[model samples]
Target: MPDPCSAIVHPCLPQNIFPLFAPRPWTLNTLHIIHRRAALARLLNPSLRLHAITYSPFSTTPLHISTPALLVCLAHPCLLGFSPLPAHPITTWHCQSPQSPPSPSRPPCCHACSPAPPPQVPVERWEEAQFTWEPFHQWVMNTSVYRRAVHRNYPMSYPCGVWANHFYKFVFIRNRKAASTTVTDNFDKCHYENSDPRLCIEVVSLNRLKERGVDPAVMWRDYFVFTTSRNPWSRAGSSYDYCSTKWARTDGPCRQPPFSAFSRDPSILGKISNLFHCFDRVGMYHDYYHTEPVAPCITTETGLPAVDYIIRYENLSSDLPEAVRIINQRRDPSLPPLPEPKIYWKKKGQAARSHEEQGVESNTAALVGHGDKYHKCGMQCVRDIYEYFRVDFELFKIPLPEADPAGDR
Candidate 1:
């Protein structure tokens, strides 16, 4: 059987034409003329099979011509009997069925054929088909809250203020100086079936958890998350006093330095120099008490807030129980009520006496009075401290303290 792709000739072409061309020398020029005529014949009747006639002296049968030569023949009109070809030319014709439809893998005829136009797609569908990163990139850029919270060194980076309780299927972000120890301790007791309230739950850092094969994405999705925020100025003062006393007991360079000396060394030459060097000796204190914005800690990968609730440390007495209720409802509605946190005065030694002696009725009043000593050096020093923690004030909706414009120096 002939090859499936071989050209076919229409029966209308004279059968005797093959013998006239068979006797000629089969040179390149002779072959070209045959191909040209065959191509023209194909064009005239696409249904026709056009073949090149070639003969060897030893055989009566014509040699099989290549498909390429036959295709080239389709290009010349004279070969199709539209006009007379050169007398020396040899041409053969065969009667066979017209070629079958081109295979799916192969394109149809040469220049005369074109690919079908691509299937039309709806505009919305096309847009959706494209993969673009702009939306995701924008979300990442909008994580200003997370960025601010991590600006200062904390124990953890990704989950800045978070404390996880796997047993309760919840995570609590304990803001610095916001009674975190109390909150975390209560969770610890709950985790151990209330066996030992003082077991001290270890607040794991996000990075460390990841290193241990815990995926943050999974944790965020599976756990109920929450955080607390405090009044920035009050928190700042409390942090300062806490760090001062804590460091005094240690042999650290910043130990026991007066807030005035700590803010800026009087002997520092440049104006901005003192500001930069302000917390150098007590860098640990600075890191621990830095402005931790709540947004970053609770933000999802899409830059949306991920926490189920936010408790205000200022109203923690009332707010915490409500937050606990929400968590319990989501996890196991039958869980027992959370124990009330024991409120303890954090001020110890001189700081405790100072607050008592001043007869300060509120934490805010006590912190402001304690923080006032730092301002003795100059309002600029206080301004510098405020600027360092400016994000905390802005994020938590706390008002900034009034500054003396003339005393910026």
Candidate 2:
């Protein structure tokens, strides 16, 4: 039979916990040294440490040595067979000279150090910046007194500060492809509980509702106003694609693609015409012009303060705090959560490259509708829309892409 110590097993423990186990040859003094060694290693480097190594009963070994050194053959029956003592004496020694310092480790050179590699940026650093705001978005959403819900229909009376005398209400004038749905959702959440109708509004185009001869003021007093816009070219393109495809149901006219069946063929011009006739103060989407366009909506048109705040679709995420501030400041304390800005397309790079490579014309009608004849009318229509809401456009800091320099041919 083999020696009784032959079956001794050295169970692996984490290096940090090594001190807890008595050192062999199972003596009180060796155990004390083991604990001290672990503490010393930890103090040297808390973040990096050597994984513990195993021992065997076959041969003599040292207690400690640096630089990938291993100690072995110290037997202890108490560790495995429940014996109380170690089988041998253990010694420690420095493998290298006492006065010499260790050599630095050399890292393998590879693609990481390539010349065109991205610059190394330190983690956990952020730029400090400050924000300024107008009255509408300044304090509206967060003011505790305003978040309460009250009863009544179109306009609910608000009880707070200078706004206490007036009834507050809002209308979400949803324009096609103009992020109106997101606006509607945010307003819907502003009231207390799901049952409160204070935050709800029937979203329809201004033109459609105005025909009913409703007082625009009575219809939209004291409420926050919001809308969105896109680059005209992209908007026209999107309108055409939606009106011609199955995806039209998502935003555009829902009565089927042939929305112009009775009037005229649904061309790009028709789509733009439909959009112009649909909403009030439709702002540009490509560059958000909330500073000007939405401001007027919150303020009175005859220039009295009516609407509370506006959010640009392009910078909606960053612009949300502004909206909250305005709403909380003027209207209600309980502002609804802001909706994430919705993006229609994702692979813009591939789509743009393909469009460029294919040399696709924006308008199907040459210079006319899709071609030459439609070009003149298209240009005029675009200008009319711009002039109608120049204040909104100008304030948002988005310069309308300079109109085609040639003008209407």
RMSD of each: 32.7, 28.3
Per-candidate Cα lDDT values, in order, are 0.42, 0.31
Clash tally, candidates in order? 7, 44
Best by lDDT: 1
- Show where candidate 1 strays beyond 4 Å: 1-161, 189-215, 248-255, 258-306, 345-353, 356-359, 362-371, 374-378, 404-409
Ten contiguous residues with the weakest lDDT in model 2? 118-127
Residue pairs in candidate 1 whose N, alpha carbon or C atoms collide under 3 angstroms: 8-49, 9-49, 35-73, 37-79, 39-73, 39-74, 146-296
Model 2: per-residue lDDT, tens digit, 1-409?
A: 4333233334422233332333333322222223323223333234323233333211112234322221223222111111111111111111222333333221121111111111111111100111123332222222223643421111111111011111233333333443445544454432336734443444233343466454443433223443344433333334443332322233454333332231122222323333443222332121112112232332222333222233333333334444444344444446553334343322222323355455753221111122221243455544543443454444333354456666642
lDDT of 1 by residue, 1-409 (tens): 5444334342322343543233333433234334444444454456554555442211212234433333222332222231112332223222233443433322223212212211111112112223244543333334322343222212222225456665456666666666566566554543455554333244555455566476654555456556665555455555555544433233444344555544432111111222333344544324332433334454432233344445554455555665666555555445554555555434322443566577754433433444555556567666655665564444333455577677643
* Lowest lDDT block of 10, candidate 1: 117-126
TM for every model, in the order presented, reads 0.44, 0.29
